[model samples]
Target: MIFIEHILERPNKKPILIDLRHNESETQPIVIFCHGYKGYKDWGAWNLMADAIANAGFCVIKFNFSHNGGTMENPIDFPDLEAFGNNNYTKELEDLHGVVDWVQNEFKHDNHIDVSQISTIGHSRGGGIVLLHASEDSRIKRVITLASVCNFGKRSSTIGDLERWQKDGVKYVRNGRTNQDMPHYFQFYEDFKANEERLHIESAVKRLTIPTLIIHGNKDTSISMDEALNLYEWKPDSKLVIIENADHVFNTKQPWESDDLSPELKTVCEEITHFLKQSEV
Candidate 1:
């Protein structure tokens, strides 16, 4: 498989780290995978997932959102908390747009990717980000969301917490895995409020005419199954698959030790490959 890591940079925006994986095929459908909040391109078994999709005969492009906290030097941990704090929905949308634009116009030639046939797969919060992008961007032909959240307005903080955030101008969420206090500036909420209509997941999903696959674990504790049901209800034509006994990460963990995917994640990847292949026809 051909593996290349490049940085997608712009004048003012922070540089986004991107990874492209595929065989020597001259032309193949493209799959752009988006990692969830606090997630990076190399998180857990995602590289393995990308390789699996590539081996299945597609070019898999996985990228880190510019403001995802990991700097160019270290793309895995929370080394740049300021950037993480400044990240908002708008920035993430722009980052996704940037990746798509690069894939369609710039990277296709070098990577032998089919710019015309593009699919996006997002996990958790990235799921919602892809949904909004797919609704607005006609270039995305298919979308697969794994353990995605249905609503962005839902507060991770309480009223008292919001009050404190308002007074302090920022709030922090502790990362249990890294033991870092990730910051969420008040502007993050402000930006979401400013673009509430554009960021509505229900409206976006309703507007999406392309094939969409919603996959969620039945035992997911982070995002409830109702969100998946809500997505299915919003897009009646979209397919929903609930894996029984799987967790939010689909049984995959950080510092993944095994060479092969966990049974649940392997199943998820199989479903994804099947869906993309079927969509091609």
Candidate 2:
């Protein structure tokens, strides 16, 4: 299998990482994964999942968003919140389009890999992104979302909170895991507000003609199961799979414990494989 780390060009000083996993000799399908807000390319068991998908006869490309708070040197956590604050939904969608163009035209993959067959997968906010992008981009043949938000226009209604964020220029949200202050400058709200129409999840999902898979955990608190149901409701042709006992992350962590995939995640992966295969026919 071919393993490569490439620096993708972006307006930001720090270029995003384009991590590729695939066998050069085999002709396989392409799968691009997008990480959620505050998430990186190498977060949790994503690398392992990439390898697993590659081994299952697909070329998997995963990348960190340009302003996902992970710098090129340390592409993991919130080292630069200023970039994060400036990130807008349109920027990320464009970044994903860039990656797709690179993979399909610029980069050479295994002989078995089929560049014409491309699928996109995203988690949390990233999930919403792929959903919206697939609707707009005709090159995307399939889309999958994990714990995706159903709407991009939802914002906190507290006038006082908005006033404080605007007054302070930046607001900090606690990272329960790392215990660091996650900064959200007033620009984040501005970016979201400006691109609300383009980022509308329901509108995108409603227009999607390609096959889609919506995966969510029953106990997910960050993005509730209702969001997944909403996605299904918007796109009735899309398949919905709910993991009964799993949480948001599907029982995996940064320093992932087992070399083998978790049962919940394995199920999700299998479902994706089945969907992709069925689509091929």
Model 2 clash pairs are: 24-110, 26-112, 27-111, 27-112, 27-113, 28-112, 28-113
- For residues 1-281, what per-residue lDDT tens digits would candidate 1 score against the true structure? 88888898899779999999888866788899999999998999998889999999999999999999999999989899999999998899999999998888775566567888999999999999999999999999999999999999885446657777889999888999999989999988888889999989999999999999999999999999999999999999999999888999999999898999999999999999999998884
**In terms of lDDT, which candidate is strongest?**
1
Q: RMSDs, each prediction?
A: 1.2, 1.9
Q: Tell me the tens digit of each residue's lDDT in model 2 across 1-281.
A: 88888998756444778998887666788999999877888888888888878878888999998888878887877787778777768779888988998887754554666888899999998998999999899989999998888887774224568888888878777877677788777777777777778888899899999999999999887888999999999999889999988788776777686888888888778888888888872
Per-model TM against the reference: 0.97, 0.93
On TM-score, the leading prediction is 1
In model 1, which runs have C-alpha deviations exceeding 4 angstroms? 108-111
Worst 10 residues of 2 by lDDT: 151-160
Query: Looking at model 1, which ten-residue stretch has the lowest summed lDDT?
Result: 155-164
Alpha-carbon runs more than 4 Å astray in model 2: 11-14, 108-110, 155-160
CA shift of 163, model 2, Å: 2.3
